[model samples]
Target chain A: GAGVSQSPRYKVAKRGQDVALRCDPISGHVSLFWYQQALGQGPEFLTYFQNEAQLDKSGLPSDRFFAERPEGSVSTLKIQRTQQEDSAVYLCASKRTGRETQYFGPGTRLLVL
Target chain B: AQSVTQPDIHITVSEGASLELRCNYSYGATPYLFWYVQSPGQGLQLLLKYFSGDTLVQGIKGFEAEFKRSQSSFNLRKPSVHWSDAAEYFCAVGPKTGAGSYQLTFGKGTKLSVIP
Candidate 1:
């Protein structure tokens, strides 16, 4: 079975540029999550979605960070005017309904120069 | 708010040696604890989780964690660690919600270096 997968495994962007990271969760997964991991640090929650509805986005750092799962399957995390501080590995995870374990994706490594 | 702590930033152990990784968490209520492993350039892999019931929980790759509510700790251990066990270990606490969401607050991680 395919686990969660993210597109653009590596992204290099200049400051002030915008980037979009995509995540494809497992088929039939009802819950999706996004997290950011800095160098030598653990992943931090960014946003969560239950189907097409985003339930928690409190972990989004700023307005520049926005995510949406419009069709209830694929989700996108967009960063506007990318900054050096926004450089990190963005991870995606998904889980089945009524399950607690989360399967993670390989993640997109974003580097803002 | 809610937070997790991995006291050891790094640990070195010889292959076939017993190993233990410390983790502690703070939450207002009963917390859901988890352990995850990450290899270089890889996604986080679930090792084990303790939501309730038995304090001792077993996971993949011969890993286990003991959740101690009195100490607010969930430490991961292995009877004998293999060289492949060298990786970054993370401790996380999931705040229970009425909606049954699994949002995790993670620790800084402990890097394990296994010696041959």
Candidate 2:
């Protein structure tokens, strides 16, 4: 079975540029989550979605960070006007409706120069 | 809100030696606890979790954890560790509420090194 996967595994962007990171959750997964991980630190929650409805976006750092899972499958995290502090790895995870565990994607590593 | 602590930033062990990783959490009630392993350029992999019932819980790759409510700790252990076990370990905690279970707070992570 294919686990969650993220695109643009490595991205280098100039400061003030906009970047979009994509996530493909597992088939039939009802819960999806996004997390940000800085160097040598654990992942921090960013947002969560149940199906197409985003139930939580409390962890998003600022207005520049936006996420959408319109059709209840693919998700995208867009950062507008990237800054040096925005450089980090963005991870996606998905869980089944009745499962307590979440499967994670390899993650997208973004570097803002 | 729940927070977890991994006291050891790094641990070095010889192959076949026993391994134990300490984890402590701060929460008002019994929280949902988990251990995850991450290799370079890979996603976090679930090692084990503690919800309720018996304190000891078993997980994949010969890993086990014991939840101690008295100490607010859920430490991961293995009888004998393999060289392949070298990776970063994370301890996470979440509220026990119905809706808050999905929001996990993770620790700083402990890097494990195995000498063959």
Candidate 3:
């Protein structure tokens, strides 16, 4: 695709529910990133993937947040037992290389009730 | 720890007036600074970045930023403001690169409101 794309632009989940957000990065990009942005705040780093390798997961907020990229092209971010505090905009970005600029996608806004 | 700070939480500018958004950072070495704009419910759009060489870097959408190492600042500027430019602006700092290391630390962002 021309740019990074995220699915389910918005999601409303009840507390303790599970939800999965998908990210389709630009073709042939070697680096992918996931971030979480709370209301009125900057986007915080969540995880990173260089192709199929998941090198950094230090930024993940808790154990309930999981991300995976199987073939290196697409990725998924799953949050289990969602809580009200978990509500935020989930953003996905991709870079041509590790040192290049990242292209971001329209975030998926998740609301937990 | 590396971090970026945007002092102003909200700024209002009149249309056709000059604009400047302040940003400061704390990093060990030469920092890769970036400016991004985000409209409501939209994705972030990169305005400009500073990697090396020239301290003054030009970006898309008639925006520019200067990286000042002495004060540890990278401020974004525009000659004239437009109503369409009203949005949230973010400042980010990150490392150049190395395998298994690619993360960007962003500021809380400045909300820009343009007056007609």
TM-score for each predicted model, relative to the true structure: 0.97, 0.97, 0.98
lDDT of 3 at A95: 91
Clashing pairs in 2: none
Error of 2 at B71 (Å): 0.3
Specify the highest-DockQ model's number. 3
DockQ for each of the predicted structures, in order?
A: 0.77, 0.76, 0.83
* lDDT (10s digit) by residue, model 2, range A1-113: 38898999999999999999999999999899999999999999999999999899999999999999999999999999999999999999999986778889999999999
In model 2, which runs have C-alpha deviations exceeding 4 angstroms?
none
lDDT of 1 by residue, A8-97 (tens): 999999999999999999999999999999998899999999999999999999999999999999999999999999999999999888
What's the lDDT for all of these models?
0.93, 0.93, 0.94
Candidate 1 backbone collisions, by pair: none
List per-model TM-scores for chain B.
0.96, 0.96, 0.97
Off by over 4 Å in 3: none
Model 3 scores a TM of 0.98
* Model 1 misplaced stretches (Cα beyond 4 Å): none
Q: Residue A5 deviation, candidate 1, in Å?
A: 0.6
Expressed as tens digits, the lDDT of each residue in B5-106 for candidate 3 is: 999999999999999999999988877899999999999999999999999999999999999999999999999999999999999988875634668899
- How well is each residue in A1-113 modelled by candidate 3, as lDDT tens digits? 98889999999999999999999999999899999999999999999999989999999999999999999999999999999999999999999873558889999999999
